[model samples]
Target chain A: MINSEHTAIMLIAVPLLGAFTTAVFGRVSSSLRNIWVLAILASTELLAVLLGVNVLEKGINVYALGASFPTLTSPEGFPVRIILEVDAMNALISLIACTITLIVVVYCLGFMRESRVLDKAYTLILLLLTGMLGLTLTGDLFNLFVFFEVVSISSAALIAFYVHRGQSLEAAFKYMVISATGALILLFAVAIIYSQYNLLSMAALAASIKYTFLDEVALVLLISAFLLKAGSVPAHMWKPDAYGEAPAPVAVMLLTSALVSLYVLFRITYTVFNPVTPTIGWTLALLGVLSIFLGVSMALIQTKLNRLIAYSAIAEIGFILLGVGSSLTQSPHTSKVGFNALSGGLFHILNDVLDLGLLFLAAGAIYYLTRENNMNRLGGLGKTHPVLGVFFLIGLLAVSGLPPFNGFASKLMIYESVYFFNPLFAIIGILGSILMAAVYVKAFYSVFLGVFPPQELGQIPKSMLAAMGVLALLILVIGLYPATVIKYLITPAADALINPGDYIGGVL
Target chain B: MALKWRYQRMLANIAYITVVVLIGLGLYAIVFKQNLIKIVMGVHIMGSGVNLFLISLGYREGGVAPIYTLAPKLEMVLPTPQALTLTSIVINLAVVALMLSFVMFIYCRYNSIDSQDRRLRG
Candidate 1:
């Protein structure tokens, strides 16, 4: 067995090396490539789970690169080397990323079986996984920026996988431009922080940050850049285009990528800049409100299936932001309401990934059958694929925060806690959930319920069904056992956010 | 002695101003340019501006290069920013190549590189 100290780095390196190895195998035989890819993903998933368990059990796990021992974070009380820190929050997000990537790869096995670029697609997917895992685990600011670029570049390449479609190319261009700009802005912020302190490790920076004018400038830049990358409204135009045009499994990965950006946003705000001013908190809260309103309103009007789902994904991001932002407003003060809001936000991230992943997979199944994206052109799919229709319904209910599903459990937390923050915010959130229900119901009706002339449709591969089933099942389990998940996973994650001392102490 | 300090400060201000101008021009190009190639150029310019700013942060007056082999009994500039700038430059190169390739595909399909082309819009 690999030593537990090495799991964090292995979670990143295995896939980075596996990506090219898979490519080489791809050149020999496709089946061999598939097997190799699966092995890599499974091992990486195992590593993530191991890391998560270790962190949960023993507190923050720090692995320093180039150190004589992996656990040596700071040599002689100075942290100069690149470090990988797995606190509860990082572990939670990494587990989510890994599990979702595994499911998507399974789905891709069936979804892309007939595509010519299957080999290249798998390579890019592995690379994308490496990037996501690295983004979540790194403890250094520069390392974070590097992984940020990695995620952006790989996902942008995957977004254009369907090169024959001009729109895919167009969407990829737009995504690349936005991501490159966001990343450069992030680099600028890192440079600003480095210039001030000459320290690159997040723990050291957080410990030493004086909140000067330059620090404030760096803070603003970091927030804006990440918010832009996270696809919040007013900076969300690239999302619909990219998600609507990319292959379905890739779209799910893209959503996770955006969620990682959201994770980083919270990490920087709460940890690096602890006790952030109320003004920053208000800025985040207001943006969250705007994203909720604008995202759903825009989603309601979208005619394309994936684009509509993409807009709703933006709204889901808003809910998480609202919870985190409201909690931030009460910084340096651990109130029950703020803690509950933060827990809700963290819990919502898991629910969002499962719920949105299910919805996108179902949409892909329909598109696979019908070769149509416009909802108007799709009908009677439910009659043909009843299981898929039920899965879609599960996704629809969950995404709209209907009861007996995971979305409701988390959204309720957001609503209840944020209501205490501001009643008006909760009111708007409730209204947005209502409108979201309407949007998805309309989508369900148009895509699955309506009658159309029967036509021959190919069967959705068992792998695809299995993937969707896994997500639906997870959603149900979480919905049924919300308290259990919150007790074990989310509360610690939220605690990690509020208390940066543990993170700093683990390193310094 | 006061004049020397003033001159050094002015030089620093001028360097910072150049960085700002480069970034501004890049943003303008990205936001305003119709041609996809020009927008990509804009991204490159913006990235260059950031890289320049990062490198400037490491500059030290009358300092030797930050190389272990080149022994000098003098101050060495901060090496981290230079390493970071190099990484940023490589990332920008990959991004530009990807963008330009996408532009090539867009042009091939649409016969135009205009980002405002209707088919590319929502």
Candidate 2:
């Protein structure tokens, strides 16, 4: 057995190595490849859970890449090698990425079984998982940018998996252009920082950052690039196209990747550029409100099933940005309300993943059964597949923050905290939730409860149903016991973001 | 002495200004051009500009290659930015190849490489 200390690097290496090995196995037999892929995913998820537990117990774990010992962050009194740091915050995000990837791979086994490009799809999926894991785990700024490109390249390839459809190819092209441009801008910013300080480690840079003129420019470039990648309003034109056209399982991973981009944004703002001015916070808050309004309003008019859900996902990102943005506005001396807002934001990430993952899976199932995604043609599905109806209804309610669901718990935290910060912010958030609920209700009525006769639909594979069931169960559990999750998980992650001193000290 | 100093400063300024122009022209092509292939070339151009900026950050007036085994004892240019530029170049290569392939498929399906064609709209 590998020592527990090496778990951090293993989390990334396992899937990276597994991806190529699976391809070689694919040439031998499909069943062999399936088993190999499943085993690798299962092990990766297990490793993530273990790493999360370790971080919870040990506070923060830092591993220097070329040092004699893994924990030796600074050999010459300064960090000279690449590092992998797992604070409570990173561990939480990595756990979410691992769980979602594992579940989606299981769903893929059923969804893509009939396709000719199954091996290539699986390879790209594992590569994407590696990128996400590396993105969350790395402590070096340059390493983070490399993994960001990795996620973008693999996801763009996967989005165009259906080569027969021109729309998928177009969507993939647009996503590639946006991601390439955004990443190049990010590289330019990184270059500026390196030229200023000759340092690439994030924690070290945070300790020494003086917020000089060039640093401020770098910050602007960094935030804009990450915001574009995170699919915030004004730069979100590529999101719906990518998410709507990609295969269903791949769409779920893409949404998670966007959330990871948001995580990077928060990390940079809170840690690297600590004590940022309130103007930046207000800018984020303004963008959040715009994203909520625009995402839901556009979702209401969407005639395609996956496209509607993609818009709703954007709205969900709004809630998180609002919560964290409000928290940031009170930085350098955060109040109790600010703390609650940050926790609420982190908790909403968990709720959003479960809610949106289930919804996208259901959309995939619909496409699988009827071979159609147009709302005008998909009717009376509930009458034929009551099980799928229940699953989607759960997703819709949770996404809209309806009661007895996890979304309500987290949104309540955000609303109450932001209300204390400023009543107007809370009012806009509540109004957005109301509009989102109406939008999903209309989608539900159209797809599941229409005035059309029942059509002959194929049976949804057991693996697909099983995937949806797991997410639905998690939502209900977290919803019913919000306090338990908030205490053990959300608080630590929020605290990690609130206090950058501990993170800097861990590395330096 | 002043003339030499001014000449060096002028060169540095030219390098920075060239970087800005390259990035600006690339952005113009991406935003205003209609042809898919041109947009892809624009992305590559933007990448080249960033890479050039990175390389310029590491330049020394009289420096040796950053190899430890070399005999020269003169100042070596900052090796880190050069390394970063190489990595960026490789990533850009992958992105350009993937994007051009996507453009090929788009053309094959739509019989047009024009991004303005309505069928590409989602």
Candidate 3:
């Protein structure tokens, strides 16, 4: 039987091999290349489902990379050789990442029906997925960084793939400049940690972060860099232009990457800086509140759909940050409030990816139907394309934290948890939810609910619907049984977050 | 504190400030400039200045180059920052080169290099 950890890893390697071959063969024929991309992504989805089944069964399974055995005394046990560590924490998240990636890949094919140079696009997509997978599974810090670079570069290249628009060039240039700066800052922090303790594994590094001024400075610097990567307010100016100008699927991919990076940031704060007495927690919480207000206020005024989504994403990030911040700062004596907030934050990450993935796909679909993504020019597409309208509705409802959806459940947890922290922030958080809902309603009314567009654009292909439908289904399932998933996946991940000693014990 | 060390600390801190001022001026030029290439050069100058600042994080009272000799000692300069500087340099080079390539692509499309003015008017 395939265990939890390497099952996901095996899933990763197959696509990596496919990506390399596709890159080699991508020059051969565009039609043949499309098949290769679809087949690989389809196979990747299969592996993710199989791996999820195993993770559900085993609770939290940690498998060594390149070797079958697991021993505490072994160097691999310390995450020395880039171990693929998967637990219930990452199992659900992994499935969502793979599922979204596959959907995006398929949607791209239909979206690029006119293009002949589509094979390079397919190769880049698979490579990006591999890097995202490696980033999710890697138990080592430097290894994670390497994978992050791989994903960042591939996605950045994907942004400029069309090369037809000056806006894309401007977006890509600003993206590279800002991203490179962040990457350098991250490397500097990693070196500081590695130099202090001759180990670069996340688990090991956390174990080694004793209370020292050096550690404090390093932690602050890392937080700054990661917030930049996470696309928080003060550091998030590039996100709107970058995401807006990129192809819609690429925009969705970048959103997932942003969530993934934030997940890493949460893991870092909980594990590396856990020992400090709650000051870091308050500081982080403040950052979250600031981002929430800024993002929402900005989103309200955006005339373009992509810019709206980008800003709203920044607002949602505030919610995640709030949950994490409250959990960190909570009195060690109170378990329920802290645990709920932390788990809620992690849950929202999964919810955000799928729901947002569908929405971006919908945006792409809308653009494909009508040449413009501007809300001003678009209206009443609902009658012409019923399926796209429903997909957009489900996505909009879920992200707005409406009832009977995954976003609602996670935001409930965040609200309840925040009630215990501060009433003002809780109110602000709800206000943010309302603002997002309002803006998206404006988005929905303008695009899907109004007057019909010109007939020249034709329908968005059925392949695109397949992708959106799958993401919608994921949101429904997670929404329906929040407790079961919370008990199984979120609990274990949050457990590891709170008692990071467990992760340290597992590795070192 | 030793007398020789006091003089060195004063001199070194002064050097840091001077370079930092030049970096600020260069960045000011980059932000306010209308030319694309000059802005890129300004960014490079600012980047190098930051790289220098990062290296200075490892500075100490009486430290030498980080290479280890046969006889082990703890008095050597902090090798960590040096390693950080090396990685930072490679990453910076990659970033700058990619930026230039994008500029070239932009030049081809627009038939001009005055990015700010063109972006504004377009």
Candidate 4:
């Protein structure tokens, strides 16, 4: 029997196995493929939850494949076997990833019966989930790059799902260009680090090259590569168009799963580049500030519901960057900033995943009734689709950081921390929140509170609604008792982040 | 030890400068080109130039070729940079292929790949 440590790796591998079997089953009946895929996700999530509980009971778990378990060196000297590591931070992230997979599966079950290539879509979805899980759990930097490419390819393919449309195709093209470029740059950075340090293990690299010129270049390059992946400021140009034109469920998935990259960005910044350069912190803060302003401004102009949601996500991401940035600063950085900021950011990460996921699903529901994403055409939906509208309202409230929602807790943590950094920056962040509130209010009024649109007086799939319900419940739960979450999960992650010694020590 | 080491450094410097100039010119073409195909070609040029520069980073004055002989005492070139350039070339090839496929898809869909034509016609 596999132990608790290996369970985390299996959670990721199971879905990749499912994706493979689903593709093979595509030769069989489509219903069989769908059923098996759903079964895989449901089982994976159940296993993940069980494993997470076990890990919480018995501290962080580590697994090494082949040669030996935990610190095995290959006889070949090449060290070819993949090593998978799971800490408390990874366990929580795994739960979140699997939960999102579960919700997305339920959502897709009834969401796309009419599409001809539903089997392919399901396979891609499973593969994407597997890639994300692998990313969050992988130990080595080279494997991280490989997992990154896998994620990118699947995401890009999903973006181009409806190839008949000009908008989707164009968006996919731009996404392809940007993502391919980002991957190459990431590969270059990885190669540079490997050549300079001669160690592929992230922990080893962290240990060796403690303070040197090569380390500086590698750290800057690593930060740049992650920032590109995270879609901060300059690299954020592709996000709006790609998310806007994607089919609604995929957009929901995008909003939810995309936080993985930011999580990775922070992980690398903290672990690999221990005591990150002050310049990098200030770069994030600067880009974050710019993104906050630009994203809100862009959101104000968008008439399309998906584009508005996409832009709002950009603004929220800026807040996360701010929190992460200010964490390392604050006049003699404390254990609190890393803990507080990442805890807030990580909590907000899940919040955005659920709240914004529900909101996008709500947008999808609206589009189902009327086959347009334009907000000008949608009105008085609450009267006709009360359940959907209410959930969306919950999402809007939660997403804009209002009271009694998950976003508020996370946002408050960051807001207080940033205030610690600079009271003026905190004020600016608050102003951004207020702008977001106004935007959502306008969104609510335009979509749900006005005279009924004849086009939207209809029904949507119950499956999608159920998915939104799951997300909405999560939003409320996380919001109400964030401290419990911090105690169990964020504290460990914060410890992991600041203490590079474990990672370095383990590798060398 | 006294064989004018300054001359080798001078050679390296010239090679580096020329590589940079080539890359810069290619980038300028990419940024300034009006035609989409030209821009694609420009990117290819820039990529190739960068790859060459990376390969040159591995070269040493009197190093033997990267082939292994049973005999010892032959200093080998830096294999890391060569490996890096090889990876870059492959990745660039993939990018170029995908980009061309996209251009074809666009042309098939809209009957033109030119941004100017599409915008003006629209």
DockQ (C-alpha based) per candidate is: 0.80, 0.79, 0.28, 0.24
TM per candidate: 0.97, 0.97, 0.86, 0.89
Model 3: per-residue lDDT, tens digit, A1-508?
5544457668779889988888666677776777877788878888877876676666445666545543333432333244666655566666767878887887887888887657677777888888878877777666666676677777778888768888888777767656655665566566557656756667767766785776777788778777887888778887887788888899888888888778777767776566656887787777888888998888888888877888888888888888888888863333788889988989888888877788888888888878787899888788888889898999999999998999999999999998888888888989989988998998899887777776755767878888788888888888898898788777877775677666666655
After the best TM-score superposition of candidate 4, give how far the Cα of residue A108 lies from its true spot, in angstroms: 1.9
lDDT of 1 by residue, A109-193 (tens): 8999999888789889989999999999999999888999999999999999989999999899999999999998999899889
- Per-residue lDDT tens digits for candidate 4, residues A282-324, read 6787777777888888888889998898888888888888877
Off by over 4 Å in 2: A69-79, A452-454, B1-8, B120-122
Better of 2 and 4 by DockQ: 2
Q: For each candidate in the order shown, give its overall lDDT on alpha carbons.
A: 0.91, 0.91, 0.76, 0.74
User: What number of clashing residue pairs does each candidate have, in the order they appear?
Assistant: 0, 0, 2, 0
lDDT of 4 by residue, B15-73 (tens): 67776677677667655765656656766776676667666667777888765556356
Scanning candidate 2 chain A in windows of ten residues, the lowest lDDT window is A70-79
Residue pairs with colliding backbones in model 4 are none
TM-score of 4: 0.89
* Residue B58's lDDT in candidate 4: 72
Candidate 3's displacement at residue A361, Å, is: 0.9
* Pairs that collide, model 1: none
Over the stretch B47-115, how does candidate 2's per-residue lDDT look in tens digits? 999999999999987888877675477888877888898999999999999999999888889899998
